[model samples]
Target: ATGGRYVPRAILMDLEPGTMDSVRAGPFGQLFRPDNFVFGQSGAGNNWAKGHYTEGAELIDSVLDVVRKEAEGCDCLQGFQMCHSLGGGTGSGMGTLLISKVREEYPDRIMETFSVIPSPKVSDTVVEPYNAVLSFHQLVENADECFLLDNEALYDICFRTLKLTTPTYGDLNHLVSAAMSGVTTCLRFPGQLNCDLRKIAVNLVPFPRLH
Candidate 1:
């Protein structure tokens, strides 16, 4: 039913320029044009500070330009839906930076973020806690709503609900994608309620930091 609206345009960002190629080769890559992608000099190597202070700042203009173009295309821009991992360098640091910029540029617009928090049981990096903490502060301060995805919970779901003895990263990602699809289904298709971003915010966000 299209939810009485058009599909929103997207802009993808990455810290490593080379990674864009692989992303473009993915199944749904056709949905994103080359011009809609922005990249930094290199990967953040799990360093939050480096990604935030260096790579993120360097690509801010390009990112904003893409956002501006996308916003212009919309009849009435609903909001931004940012999906990123809180434990990684680019996702944590650059995601925070982008959220801050979006808030500054579009103060009246609703900004919702889907942040993936690292699992404590199978954490690969020692500095994940620091990255998660700092990025969370930005999510709380800048984003109108933040949906947290815990890796541990996701893993358990894969192991138990899916009945997988050893679930791969792809399995966990599928769960995440499914969850996102469910949350966004009301907006993507006709629904009795919560069919718009603002309505979703009104229903979910009771306070500034509650979401």
Candidate 2:
């Protein structure tokens, strides 16, 4: 059904240079052009305020430029899908800011997010809970629908099912990607339900704030 129509024209942004290493050298590097990447030249340093206010503020205009360009290229832009982690400073703070900005520009478009929230059992940093709480507030206001993934639950799957002694970020990411692919199956394939993102949102989200 897709015939390459569903091949997303995406722009990836990261505050830290090291974080984008995989994107430049990974197996899927060919999927993206050099212009599709944006780097802030500095890290958020696990501080939500730094990400939201300083680095995010400085980089947002350039980010929006790319976003507008992509949207203009699309024949019929359905919506935006942002994937980020609520526990990390850049992913949480900058991600929240970006979604809000996107919402302001594209008021009628569906703003969906693949959010990875912090968990007590698999804690990474001390202030992860605080970052997540703050990020959640913005997501509630900006995002139309959120697909949340718990860090602890994913860890459990890696431990029990994959039998990995120490599961890497790549393993967890693969799991998340697999789940996303499953969710969007109806969008790309012929089916009885044949649901789009809006239809899925209609059925799943009974109330606007609940998502």
Candidate 3:
């Protein structure tokens, strides 16, 4: 959650560095910290411009550079897990960039991504859902599987929870917690898997691979 040193292989790379720090201090530290994932103007050569929507599209090569090196170095990170919002602006652009770069690094690694897209009436930002949806489809083509969280579908739940003023951060956190729980649960309880996922993810392992 809050580590100055070794970050867990699992971290969500969303939000700005400043905001991520606040999220860490806010008690959701374990899930939304910087060390766990990388994105958003972290380094100068991050292959992104300062603008919003363009940043994601700008960093495809940069993301892959980091991922390839990272996966090669760590045994725990055989596969890379990434996240981006399909909501608008940075999420889709950046998510697409990261995913494109990932597919290029076709070693033994598998790239898993989670994205949330904006609803039509959400605001002016909603206009790009078409492009986001398209990019999401392309990513699905390369990824093992793609999971989509639709904002329109979620609005009813948010409205029902008295979050009409705006969606509460707590609600968002719960959603993330649930998604993660679902994945782990699908695999079964700790140390108890419902299936043997032991097939050598040769791509995930640094090659020459050991599957």
| All candidates: CA RMSD (Å) | 3.3, 2.7, 7.3
TM agreement with the true structure for every prediction: 0.92, 0.92, 0.62
| Candidate 2 RMSD to the correct structure | 2.7
lDDT comparing candidate 3 with the true structure: 0.53
What is candidate 1's local distance difference test score? 0.86
Residue 108's lDDT in candidate 1 = 89
Q: State the displacement of the C-alpha of residue 89, model 1, in Å, after optimal TM-score superposition.
A: 1.4
Ranking by TM-score: 2, 1, 3
Clash number for each model: 0, 0, 9
Q: Candidate 1: which stretches are off by over 4 Å?
A: 1-8
Worst 10 residues of 2 by lDDT: 1-10
Model 3, span 109-156: residue lDDT tens: 556566665566654453565656656565655555455566666666
Q: Write the per-residue lDDT of candidate 2 for residues 1-211, one digit (tens) a residue.
A: 1445334487899998775777778877756756768889887888888889999889989999999998998888889989999888899989999998999999999998999999988888999999999999999899989999997899899999999999988899899999999878988898756367787788889888999
List ranges where model 2 is wrong by over 4 Å.
Answer: 1-8, 163-165, 192-194
Across residues 1-211, which tens digit of lDDT does each residue of candidate 1 receive?
A: 1445433377889888777877778877655656888987678989898778987789888999999988887798888999999898999998899899989999989898889898889798999999999998888899987888988998899888989999888898899889889888999898779988889988988876788
- Which residue pairs in candidate 2 collide? none
Error of 2 at 75 (Å): 1.0
